[model samples]
Target chain A: EPEVTQTPSHQVTQMGQEVILRCVPISNHLYFYWYRQILGQKVEFLVSFYNNEISEKSEIFDDQFSVERPDGSNFTLKIRSTKLEDSAMYFCASRGDTEFFHFGNGTRLTVT
Target chain B: AQSVTQLDSHVSVSEGTPVLLRCNYSSSYSPSLFWYVQHPNKGLQLLLKYTSAATLVKGINGFEAEFKKSETSFHLTKPSAHMSDAAEYFCVVSGPTGFQKLVFGTGTRLLVSP
Candidate 1:
């Protein structure tokens, strides 16, 4: 079965550095999303994208954050300035006009 | 607004015993519920979903969940537990109110011991 794939299973960066997390959603899917789970905390929604634009975003997804399809199959999340609090497991998900969302294994981001 | 509550944060059962994970939901309209499991350092895997289908929904790994509108609950269960069943389970709800955005619960961690 085709599944969403994320790169850099783990990342380490210094505070104030820029980082871009990459994801390849399932082919033919129409919607994409970004969520994160802080260690020992509940998963929180970050942003949702459709039609090559952001459809909705949570307060956590501030100006420091942005998402882009960039290409037909690649979905990327960029954080302009990483903070210590940005450390978490970032997950990418996709769906096709359905409530069912397939999630990627996740990228563990650690900022010093 | 839509939300789900996982009653128990953790549950322990011996191998071959029964397993139960409780969940409660609140929604203004008809809601869709789902059960997702995540092993340590793994992604969330959908176990089953209740989209106003049969009241009792069976899923992979011999697991099932019941949607009870009267009780506003959708609890997951299995007759016998296997060591592999140990994982963190999340109850999620989505409604038209939020463009089908899923609201996840805190999650319940099940431990199956021998």
Candidate 2:
């Protein structure tokens, strides 16, 4: 089956550096989303995108965070200034008309 | 708002034995419930989902979940546990409307032993 794919399975960056996590959602999917799971914590929603604009975002998605669909296929989450608390496994998901969301393996971001 | 609670952090079952993972949900309206499994280094896979259609929802890999509105629960069950069933299970909930953001439970780690 076709699936969502994420690049740079693991990323390590300095605390003040900028980092971008990339995802290629299923080709035909419409809605795109980003969620994060801190170690030992519940998965938290970051943002949702449709039609190249953000539909909704959580409080966790603050000024430092931004999402872009630079190309029709690539969805990216960029952090302007990484913080230690930003370290987590970031999952990208997309769904078609169906309610089910298909997720990528996830990008493990380690801010040090 | 919608939320899901997975009762157990971990559950262990022997091969050929039944497997049960408890989950409860809180939703302001009729919620869409789901169970997803994540194996090591793998992406989240939808095991099953409960919309308004049927109370009993059957999923892949011999897994099923029952939606009990009164109990506010959607617990996952399997008649027989297999070694391959070991993984992290997440109970998820979404709003009644179409395609809402999914709220996930902390998750239950299933360990199937020989």
Candidate 3:
């Protein structure tokens, strides 16, 4: 089965540094999403993208966060400035005609 | 709008024993409920989902969930447990419409002991 793939399984960056997490969604998927899971916390939604524009975003997706579909296959989430609290597992997901989503393995971001 | 709640924070069961992970949901519409499992250092894997179809939904890896509308619950169960079954399970809910905007539960950590 085709699946979503993420690069840089683990990322370590100092506080105040910029970080970009990359994902290659399923080829045919039309919608994309970004979610994060803090250690010992629930998975939290950040943003959703369709047609190269953000559809919706949660409060957790603040000024420091941005998403881009730079190419037809690659979707990325960039954090302008990493904070200690930003340490979490970031998951990328894609959706097609159905509402079901295929999630990537996730990028573990450790902002120290 | 939709939300999910995983009742237990942790559940331990011996191998060859039955397993149960409780979950409850609240949705303005007929919610689409799902159970996802995450092993240590691994990504989330879909176990099963209920999209207003048969209440009893069977998923991969010997796992299953029953969506009880009356109880607003979709609890995951397995007849026999294996060491590989140790993982964190998340219950998720999404509104009937939209781009699969999901609300996830805090998750239940299942520990299978041999």
DockQ top scorer: 3
* Candidate 1: residue A29 lDDT (0-100): 91
Could you give the CAPRI-style class of model 1? medium
DockQ of each: 0.71, 0.76, 0.89
- Per prediction, the TM-score for chain B is 0.97, 0.97, 0.97
Model 3 per-residue lDDT at B41: 94
> A1-112 in candidate 3: lDDT tens per residue?
9999999999999999999999999999999999999999999999999999999999999999999999899999999999999999999999997978899999999999
Model 2 chain A weakest lDDT span, ten residues long: A37-46
Indicate whether candidate 1 or candidate 2 has the larger TM-score: 1
lDDT by residue (A41-110, candidate 2, tens digit) is 7889999998889999999999999999998899999999999999999999999877889999999999
In model 1, which runs have C-alpha deviations exceeding 4 angstroms?
A: none
- Better structure of 1 and 2 per DockQ: 2
Query: How far does residue A107 in candidate 3 sit from its true spot (Å)?
Result: 0.6
Cα lDDT listed for each candidate: 0.94, 0.94, 0.94
Poorest 10 consecutive residues by lDDT, candidate 2 chain B: B94-103
Q: Candidate 1, residues B13-63: lDDT per residue as tens digits?
A: 999999999999999999999999999999999999999979999999999
TM-score of 3: 0.98
Ordered from best to worst DockQ, the candidate numbers read 3, 2, 1
Clashing pairs in 3: none
